[model samples]
Target: MAALKILGKSSSINVRKVLWTCAEIGLDFDLTEFGSGTPNSVTTPEFLILNPNAMVPVIQYEGQVLWESNTICRYLAARHQRTDLLPQDPMARAQVEKWMDWQATELNNAWRYAFMALVRHSPAHRDTAAIEHSVREWNRHMSIADLQLQRTGAYLVGDQFTLADIVLGLSLNRWRASPIAHANLPALQTYFDLLCKRSGYTQYGANGIA
Candidate 1:
């Protein structure tokens, strides 16, 4: 099969999600970075033809075009039958998918305002009150993840490292790199350290890009 073509900048957290997943699955793919620190190439007419939403991390796999970072990761795992990263059992898969969804929706949404204000410094996100609220919310969501890690005593789902870790790990990296003040989360800290041991995390995740 041909190498998957990924469209997105390496500095993007979402794009890094796909890159880290490919590393975990040992999948060979080519990346076309578009929108790193300048005007987004996603809005270009040619790029829009690939993804109508004009988002990065779109993948061209075989003859199919796919978008959504987490979904793209799931597709790559399933395609390679990497059940180790994504289990095949119905219940096991659901367990993994649950955390993946949480990271994409709950966790990701909680950090947007704070990340935009403190990190991206977006003019539109200058509401100090809203930024503080978002920071608190982001920490709260991360605390939930910490509790889960405590329960599992290992990865998010259990002893096995699944797709859940891939998405959540990237989010954790962002949370750590963000300038927002965070509550003490020892479990989360240890989890981040553990993820760092993976070459994939070192290369695509913990590359000081935040």
Candidate 2:
């Protein structure tokens, strides 16, 4: 298989999502660092041509350019026919996509403020009230994940691991690595432990970049 040309820094969670997916699929890729302060920064005109949004993860495959981390992951899985990662059944696919979308929209939104403030130390995100609110919402959303894990007793969408776990697992990694207090979630912890057994998870998802 031809190696994919990926534009992103490995430290980026978004980029790591693609890396983990590729590892799981045994797909080969060459990554160019397009993060802030790098020589090939995302702000550069050349980088913007590939991804107008200036996002870190833009994939070039067979003359096609694709952005959005979750979309890239799904596309790779579908392209490789990895039904174990992304099922063909409509309902199962929808279930996996639902959580992937939640991770991108709801879960990401909930954690951004606190994560920026506490982890990135972004001056713009230092408001104490905002950080507290963000932490509360983040934990609440994770509790919902815990409930789902309790129901499945394994992966997000039942016993089978899917794309949902890839996205959510990284989010969970970020949450754990952050200094914030986590809710009492035994099932979620078990799920994390299970994911740890996967080489792809250890390689990309849990590489301590939180």
Candidate 1: the clashing residue pairs are: none
Could you tell me every candidate's TM-score relative to the true structure?
0.96, 0.98
User: Which pairs, if any, clash in model 2?
Assistant: none
Task: Estimate, for each residue in 11-65, the C-alpha lDDT of model 1 and write its tens digit.
Answer: 8899999999999988888887777465557888988998988888899989999
- Alpha-carbon RMSD of each model: 1.3, 0.8
Position 107, candidate 1: lDDT:
88
Those runs of model 2 whose alpha carbons end farther than 4 Å from true positions after fitting are none
Candidate 1 Cα deviation (angstroms), residue 138: 0.5
lDDT of 2 at 15: 93
lDDT digits (tens) for residues 99-207 of candidate 2: 9999999999999999999999999998999999999999999999999999888999999988899999999999999999888888888999999999999999888
lDDT of 1: 0.91
Residue 162's lDDT within candidate 2 is 88
